[model samples]
Every structure is written in structure tokens, then in C-alpha cells.
Target: MKHTLYKHIQEGKTTGKKSFAVLVDPDKVNEATTEQLVSLALDAKVDYFFVGGSLVISHNLDECIRQIKVSCSVPVVIFPGSHSQISRYADAILYLSLISGRNPELLIGQHVISAPTIKKSGLEVMPTGYMVIDGGAPTTVSYISNTAPLPADKADIAMCTAMAGEMLGMKLIFMDAGSGAKNPVSIAMIEKVSSHIEVPLIVGGGITNPEKAYLNCRSGADIVVVGNAIEKDASLIRELSDAIHSVPVRV
Candidate 1:
């Protein structure tokens, strides 16, 4: 029932303080890289570490969270890809409902199977509306979820979906372009959605550089997440984090 992570995000939205989150996929990072990431995150003062991925084929999820916990004070949140991705080690979980797709399994089916376990795990649950925006490529998330992403250019659809999620009482709205995306979500879509929703807005995928991260925050994303890009070049962490945190909070 703790609202620590959610409260921080809500406050950030209210204050117009943009947050930068580093997405760490257990399948992609080893202990060494995770340690390296921890060091960078501490230096950059990252807001959160999102653990999990679209298709995690490894058994390192728990250990990944442990490693992060022992290394830094930054919050660790599970951006779970499936029911099996839950971990007691993390501080919080984004209990995502895939609102952008018609797949019943993603919207509610997965939640049912995971709810009991999540409750038992004692992780702070963040009811999130997860919308996957087309990232100009066929990414793993679309294939694994068995859902098509919202078209990149369709701002209206994205806006309405976010509005519906907010009305449904979801605590957060996450719009992702999917990892390894060729293009991030459009500014127009982000602006449209953020303007409509009262909850904090999260935008991720295809945000490879500080400039892109800065733009996303300026466009209205309260939190910007990056993963694949950091996986390839760990040095970008500071730049990306700095860029996101530097945006002047809009009044």
C-alpha cells in the first residue's frame, strides 16, 4: 500500500520536474554491466531503474534487482513484460494494462494471473495504462504481446486511450515506442496525451540521445525511459539523464 514511488512521480508532474529512468533488461545485462550502470546512475542521479523487458529469456531478473539495490539508493521498478517477471526485490512494479491493444490477455487476463502473486510479493503496485506506439519498426513488444502498436502519427487515438485509462483510475500512463525503435513517439502525440491526462505521463523507446530525451520532457513526458541505447553504449546514461533533468519545469 506504500505510495512512495508513485508519490514521487506525481509530485514531479505537479512541479513540472522531468524525470529520467534507465531501463535495464535482465536478459541483456550481466552483473558487470549492471554494476557499471549503477555507478553511472548514481553519478547522474537517475530517478529510477526499470527492470524487465518484452521477452526476458534469462533467470537473472532477481539478481539484477539485487545488484541494483546493493549498489545505489535509486528506486527499482519492475516494468514487467509478463506475469512471470515479478520480483520481490524491487521497490515497486508497474502493473501495466495494455490499453492500446484489443488483446484481452494483455488488458486484464495477465493482471488476473499476476494479481495474487503481486499482492503476496508486497511490491507497491502502480496501475499503469501501457500504450505501445509504432516506433517505425516491428519490435519485440508488439510480437510478444500479440498486439499492434498505435500508429505513430495517430495523436487522437493515443490521447483518447490515455484519457480512458485515467478515467479508469490508472495511476500512470506509459507510452512506449518499443526497444530498438527507429523513431520515438511524436511530440504531437505526447503533447496531445499529456494535455488530456492528469496523471504523470511516461514516454520511452527510441530515445537514444540527450536531445531526444530533452525534447520528450519538453513535449510533456514526466518521465523518459531508455534501454537498448544504453545497452549498446553505457556512456550515454549521464548525458541522457542530465538532459532530462535539465528541462525547466513548465508552470
Candidate 2:
């Protein structure tokens, strides 16, 4: 089967609808908890399930993905933090390049190391430019990657970085504020980048409610991802899905 990430985004574009993605971090949840979360996400009509985290402390990634795939019908996309996170069972991988930081390791080094395996696995490779914005708190991604985030207040710099990624042939742009962020990316910054980028835009981190998700959609985020929030209250999945899907698309 083809990766559902591309299919879901295409479907959203065709229907003039926004997409909802639920992120699953293996390091954060155990087997039983992960299964329950996947079931809840599917029941809530989540458009896609993104697996992977900054730290895959557990070696059960493959098994985790396999179990989740069997339990849910939604597409599972690997939002890998490193090349080690790749698995054939996933429908696709967000071949990410961290654009906000100057660290060459995340920008291209990791991609080069994993390219052959990724190609051989036949997983859909969605080239995504990952941009991290300062979210007021230190996130695991920042600490582990050894990179600094772009200033949240600097829209111009963020725009430039996103444009560079686009020029580099990236298919998508993901602006993250980090998991459990103190504050999410500002609407002003999202608007600035979304207005300039033609590719799909995904925003995540620190979004705790449907209202924030709705704000992101209105500000032009093609997809809104919620992880910690849903981890706390799986029931919020339905509310978030409804909120994102209810946004009025521009005619």
C-alpha cells in the first residue's frame, strides 16, 4: 500500500479541507498505552498517525509500528528523528531535514546515511523541511540534536529558512515548537511562512486544545499535530479532529 501521508494530504487538498495528524512517540508510551492511543485516534477520525520521536530509547520501534498498523486503518508515517527509526512497516517516512538549525548532521548527513535503506524499503519518502522555533522551554529535540532554535519573533529569518528548504526541493514544511512547549509558534510566524510556501505546512508542539488547532488551520497550517495533549486525554482527539476539519477553506 502507498504511504497514507501523501494520500491524506492530497485528499485534504482535493476536498478543500484541513488535515489532522496524531503523533505517537515510542519513547513516551508503552505497548498497551500506544495501542490504546492508536485505537482512540482512529475512532476520533485522525487523518494520519505519525510515529517516531527525538529519542527512540526503546529498540521496539519495528514491533510497535507493526502492532499499531494491525490495530488501526489510518496511515502510519515515520517522523524519524534519526535514520535508525526507519521501518518497512510504515506507510511512509517524513524524510526530514532540520532547516532551522545550523547542524549539518540533521540537515543532510543523516539523510545520506539512510538514503539507500529508505530507497530499498519502498517506503514513500516525503521530503520535509523541519524547522524548530523557540518555544520558551528546552525540548528533547533541541537538547539531543545539539542545535539552537530560531527566534520565535523573527518572521523574516523563519521565512528565509523555509524558502531555502523549498529551493532545496522539499515537498513539505514542518514548523515545530517542541513537545510540551511553553508556547506554540506564533500565528504571525505561521502566517508569514504559509503565505510564502506552496508546499503543505504542518504545525505542532504545545497545542493543548481545539481552539489552538483551529487557530493554526486559520493561520494556514495544512496539518495540525497533537501529541502530549492527546496523550493526556485521548477523548480530546475527537474535538481536535472536528475543529481542524471544520475550518473554512479559502475558495
Candidate 3:
């Protein structure tokens, strides 16, 4: 079945709830560990699974996605870092444009390279406006993408960047703090962006606890993505899911 992420978000809104997603970076975990993680995530009642990495130095991207798709019942989406990460096995891809960075490579260069392959794969393409916020530390994404992050204190700049993306016809806005961040994207920043953008807002990175996830949702984030946190303690998944779901839906 073809999965529509936008439809899922609308359904959540209609049902008056928020959703939880878990990110699985294949490059970071071994096969045995990945299998266990998939099982744990499935058991946790996570709404979706996102698979990808900033640097997939491993040539096993396709194999890793295949395994996860076969092992888990939840929808598996590709949160790709580069064009090379595309595969037919996944349900969809977050076709991201790094709007926050001045680097033209991430903004349009990579998309041009990946477009043909993506069209051929017949995967659902979710046009996402990606904005990286300062995480209080240097992160893999910031280093590899060669783009400086927007200062965490600068909510106004972030707002304008996101609005520009929406005007450019992007479907969703993802505000990320980069994995293993010293601090997650602030609630103030999330609130500012969420209030401005008409598209669904997805907040991620450094969200290590249920409280943090809950706070993001309460601040108006339409979806919350958790990665490194669950990798360390798989058992926290259920708690985080419940916490995000506990927030009152925005009217």
C-alpha cells in the first residue's frame, strides 16, 4: 500500500492527537543490534520509522532498509542525507532541501542528482524544508553538509527561512538540532516556527526524554522524531509515545 505522510498528519489532526516517529541510522548500528532495535520500536507503539544517516559510508544501505522493512510492521521512510541513499524497498523519502544553509549543494544540487532515481523508484516524495538549528555543539550533519546552523537564539531568522521554503512550494518544515546535540531545538524556536508555517512542522534531534517530546508538541510541533534517545534505552519508547500523545491537539 502507498503511504501518504501528509494524509497521516491530517488524520492525526482530525483525531485530535500528535504522532511519534523513531529514526534508525543504519550506519550507526550493526545488523544484530538493528534487528533488536526494530523489534523494540514496534513494541513501543511508534507511529513510524525513519532510516538514514548523514554519512552512509557503509555500502549496505539497501540491505539495511530491506531488513528493517521485513522485520517491522510500521511504515519505513527514508530520511536520506544524500542522493545515494534512495532505495525501492522503503515506503517513502523525505526529499529535503536545507533552507537554513547558504550552501547551494543541499538546497538544490543534491535534489537535481536524486530526482531521476527517485522518480524511477516510485516512492512517495515528501518535499521537506530542512532547517538546522544550533545544537550548542558541532554535529555530524553541520560538519558534513558544510553549512553553519542558524543560531538557536535567532527565532526570527528561522521563521523567515521557513516561510520562504513554504512560499517555494515545500510541503513540510523540519527543524532539527542535529543528533547527539548538546541541547535540543528550543521550545521558543519551535513555537515561533510552528506559529508561522502553514505546513506540518516536524521537530527532532536531542529529544532524549518524554518531557522534551511533550514540550515540543505543546509548543505546536505537529510531529516529533526521536533517534539517539531510543537507541540508548529502547524501553523509553513507550513512555515517549505516551507523553507526546498526551498533549492536547491544537485547534
TM-score of each: 0.98, 0.95, 0.94
Ranking by lDDT: 1, 2, 3
Among these predictions, the greatest TM-score belongs to: 1
The deviation in Å at residue 198 for candidate 1 is 0.4
lDDT of 2 at 231: 79
RMSD of 3: 1.8
Per-residue lDDT for 114-133 in model 1, tens only?
Answer: 99999999999999999999
Local distance difference test, candidate 2: 0.88
Candidate 3: minimum summed lDDT over ten consecutive residues — where? 1-10
RMSD, every candidate, angstroms: 0.8, 1.7, 1.8
> What residue pairs are clashing in model 1?
none
- Per-residue lDDT tens digits for candidate 2, residues 70-136, read 9877888899988899999988899999999889999999889999999899898898999999999
Error of 1 at 55 (Å): 0.7
Candidate models: Cα lDDT each = 0.94, 0.88, 0.88
Across 37-64, the per-residue lDDT of candidate 3 in tens digits comes to: 7777777778888889898888777888
State candidate 2's TM-score.
Answer: 0.95
